[model samples]
Target: MYFSIEPKTSKEDLFNFDEPYAALKKCIGLNEERLVVVFGLRRTGKTSLMKVVYNELDMPKIYIDAREIFPLTPLSTNQYLVSIFIEFARKYDIIKAILEHVSAVEFVLRAEGKEREAILSSILKNINAEMQKRKTHLVIFIDEAQLLKPTGADRLLAYIYDNLKHIQIVVAGSEIGILEEFAGQNKNASLFGRAKKQITLNRLRPEQSFLFLKKGFAQAKKQISEKELMAAITEIDGIVGWLSMYGWHYLKIGSKKALETIVKDGSKIIADELEAFLSYRGEARRRYLIMLRTLSIREMRWNELKRTLELEEKKKINDSHISNYIEALVNYGFIEKEGINYKLADPLLKRGLDFVKI
Candidate 1:
């Protein structure tokens, strides 16, 4: 009752939900040429933050989920060009204004499957012209941005980072390591040699979470003990999504022993989420995830991973195969490398992985 866990539609509600709002304001103020990459694990509420910022600002904004635009499969360059045009159509007179600047408007309209670099160049020029006239910066927030790699448009991102002077782009994805992979370690990589601002979304602290639950409980005219709050927070480890589900459970049960029920139900909920994530992945991914979980208990070196694999019941892992598995896992946001050591990307996911295994 009176809980705020849904997608935030307004500015005030979004800022008040969680995390520091002041820092967001500061980030928005820095509308430099460099694209700001805001990424975290799944369910970290990056989309909510973008929606809030867009609503607060008066500038014309366009938000798209890159997952929909760019899936796991490869897409033609023409298709990429079309998606950009389609997204711009949402804003009034935006597309029309762009088309007005180009002399070969019919050429862009008629282009089919594959096209020349010239057509793409013309489209970019018109769009850039429209962007300049508005003096109103465009914020393109791409959710699930890792989906774009298969399209080979990862370089297109570099193009935008280098050329788009008027638009302030913000790309968000669940996979931190993979997104960085697209950005590449090379100096020529777009956004390479440029300062990157990373914002990590961690779970709520126990005190803050308890305060939230207490406030909600008070509003519902129900009383809950400090012990109960502590117990619930400990079980969920202050994950907002899990905590919100627990609140929902408490509201339904309304029992003196709500804490125990909430913990039981919360574990099931977390397990269900893990199952959904794991279901889509393969055995190699699973093994990689388990390896990450093992490392999470304590940091593991490359040699240690090799030794652990060698001690396996039967098969020995090849270096290439191991590298590929590790890359896929890291790309999907399951495993992370700190120098030569590795760990799970999120501690909550680590706990869920550990719990689900048994």
Candidate 2:
């Protein structure tokens, strides 16, 4: 169904991504690249695209959601690695081999630090050998890969890309800059200077957004006025996640309640995300919030935003600091630059800023 909240597995339910879908399928099918990176802002359907391709592919595959292992610690990382090995072993009916390779299942679970990483590398090496013996490729999809940075999975990903030719890694992340950093798009990283297939998903245009809502409501067999649809489109804009949520809620409640609920629900969600982003920023957190809250009001040029921040602090702020702050926000997908002005990326973010304290 169009309004279903889960990541889409079927292409029939996906909308307006024909080019990307076809391109991704071809990229994975040809197996020309060791690494594929799918990049996009939040709610632009990166996960749905990944899931759909995963379902259609006719090869051995594994999908890992790194978000599940967040707040990464030695124990959690160890357990996650064991789980991956267990899944792979069960899929290939190689439980006996894995147990023999590790000597005991408990050792796999109890190992930590460098020992755990060595075990994971050994497991992948074994899987690669098995795939080579079978003469098949194993496609592994790691979603939200930016979260895996703390776990040092990038080194392992590099290892696979370098040595395990039969194992292909596809990673997707909503935080574009962070994902790139994790994937070695920057210098001095493990996978730097390697060939990679990159795909990006973007928000729908106004016309496309309207058509999406029209078709979605039609599929649901619900009646919604054109005027109401336009209002929802204006408020929600082009993000598919918000559009799907609004449609789902409209089917359950009425349009009025649905829109109200989206505001309440979306604001809290974005606020919580912003809070998480700020948690480790220390003194810079206040500056980020100020810049974000200011931009939430309206788009502003660099000088104007700096002036606003200065006024709020009643003191001078360095130009370099202002530049860094704007750059950080843009990298994190919170605000974007158009021409000389910077504005919040999502319409709902303005309302979300109201819920943020300071």
Candidate 3:
């Protein structure tokens, strides 16, 4: 049977680009420079971007996805560092063996009151020791990397980046705001003033979405009307995951009415997410989410949003407060703005707002 959701092939998965190779080339060009901050709203293809660019670099590379190793939410920065390094040691044999050897030194150093620093300090020493013995360069990538607790990660990254000549380190995450929050401008901090390059991964434009849809339908041996295809794109606002879901939904429905149902059903998924946002505690956050939802459905002027807020009987929110709410939302990565206009940065959120009652 043909599949609608098979892992998009490396070539076909280039979702939004007529020339993904060119995009990959731009990313590869960054390798000659210092750290590149690869970030985007969740599922805007940040990880895919990393994979494509990293593939071009011919080096001994390691990709560590932090999502796989759950972040310790309650831990302090120092404690988090210990946990992260322990996890790192347990997984990579070369790093593990090197650390184990350093633990011997650590045990001795503990008696001299240097045990705390010994683990991290000696790990670096061991990396150099290994490099001399093995004669190779190391490129390490940490994914979902925004989750790394700021305090400890700052110190660790700074030390590694400052000292390690042979190891090229790259950190990427789905949430750009989270990373910016982590890398605050404290000179003593790990990544302070250290991001040599920053890259933003956004959704495929409308034209790119059309191309991907056509390519995907051909692969699945299905044909879609231009109206149906454009409807899906408008509904999902050009997010790849939602586009793929539309393709999957289109394949299962045989009738035109069934197609309408798929769109309606998808809208409900959007609505549920919107309800969750509005109901979430923090009045400013709720208002911001609601405002973004409204913007997604139809553009509203500043005073118009105030008027709309006043009309809501259940939501006793203030018109003047909307600006502050929008600022907070933008800071926290929930929404984005261009001049006076603003909208939900994530398309799924847009669908959820569409599901919300007028």
Candidate 4:
């Protein structure tokens, strides 16, 4: 199931995390609760690792994907928490009895007046009390939590974490912008400085990447040529999500064009994120595209990047403008700083240079 291109929610598919798992076990140990945030770039196994930890922890849990509930089809905060409550009730037999009296959860889904807020809060408190009685932690996990809106959910979470000792809120976000701006280092955000622990997942090293592919293929009852697979790993760059996609394709066609799979199928997903990062810039899209393309080729100092953009735009770009762009790109995960130089985080993104223009 590690080779599954679709979502894999089981711990059995988890790999290379004896250290991270153990650390998380210590962080979220019995009654040692805090708001935990797991962050990383796309294709890293943030969700899978959380599931692995979830399986190990003996607690009542609900995993809500903000990507589904927030963007594209936005859900109000009431509806969001109500869904979590429903899932928790469904998972625990004891909560099913309380579910019958939870008319407010159903009513607040459509109506969000002050009265509704109080009603929903009371219900969450009631559920919290029941969880405490059972001596099991009430863990609510929100994946892609960057998509979560500023609906005072954090205030509610802060209230719960401070008062309801049995409740724990763990969120994971793949986009750096969402994670940082929403909860990390940002002083003004609700959960800022409140995350009990923060864990970042990085791409596997070369040897680990090889073993990951080998084991994933074995899990799927398929085989891959060692040479071709290594070449594919080079192309995929230790991104497990893309590897899963490539393996899914390899099983069908028996081909070794993992780079092709990444560029063709995965381009839009990456481009969409980049575009989302540059969404606020009105006339600077072309500059960003040219700069990203330039860095994709090689790392460049600030002066060099500014000169490249000047030549590309056929207009003078001030030093401050280019510096701001570089900083923003680095912060948003498109560009990484190496010493005093900057380069695209994923060189594979160069293949979609055209998409960046729009």
Name the better of 1 and 3 by TM-score. 1
Q: Model 1 over residues 1-358: C-alpha lDDT tens digits?
A: 3345565556543323544444554555354635667666555566667667666776656676775552344434345555565457445466665554244434545654344445555566566667677665556666666667666656666666667766566767777777776555445555467555566665567787888678767767888888877777766565565566566667876644455665555446555655665676666545655566567678787767766765652568788876766776676766668898876654455555646652
Give lDDT tens digits, candidate 3, residues 182-204: 55444654677775556666777
Q: Estimate each model's TM-score.
A: 0.74, 0.94, 0.72, 0.85
Residue 101 lDDT in model 1? Answer: 29
Reference-based lDDT, residue 139, model 1: 61
Give candidate 3's TM-score. Answer: 0.72
For model 2, give the 10-residue run with minimal summed lDDT: 96-105
| TM-score leaderboard ranking | 2, 4, 1, 3
- Judged by whole-model lDDT over C-alpha atoms, candidate 3 comes out at 0.59
- Ten-residue stretch with the least lDDT total in model 4: 66-75
Misplaced by over 4 Å in model 1 are: 1-5, 11-20, 29-33, 70-90, 100-121, 184-191, 216-222, 253-286, 289-306, 314-330, 335-358
**What lDDT is obtained when candidate 2 is compared to the true structure?**
0.85
Clashing pairs in 2: none
Model 2 collision count: 0
Model 2, residue 260: what's the lDDT? 94
- Look at candidate 1 and give me any clashing residue pairs: none
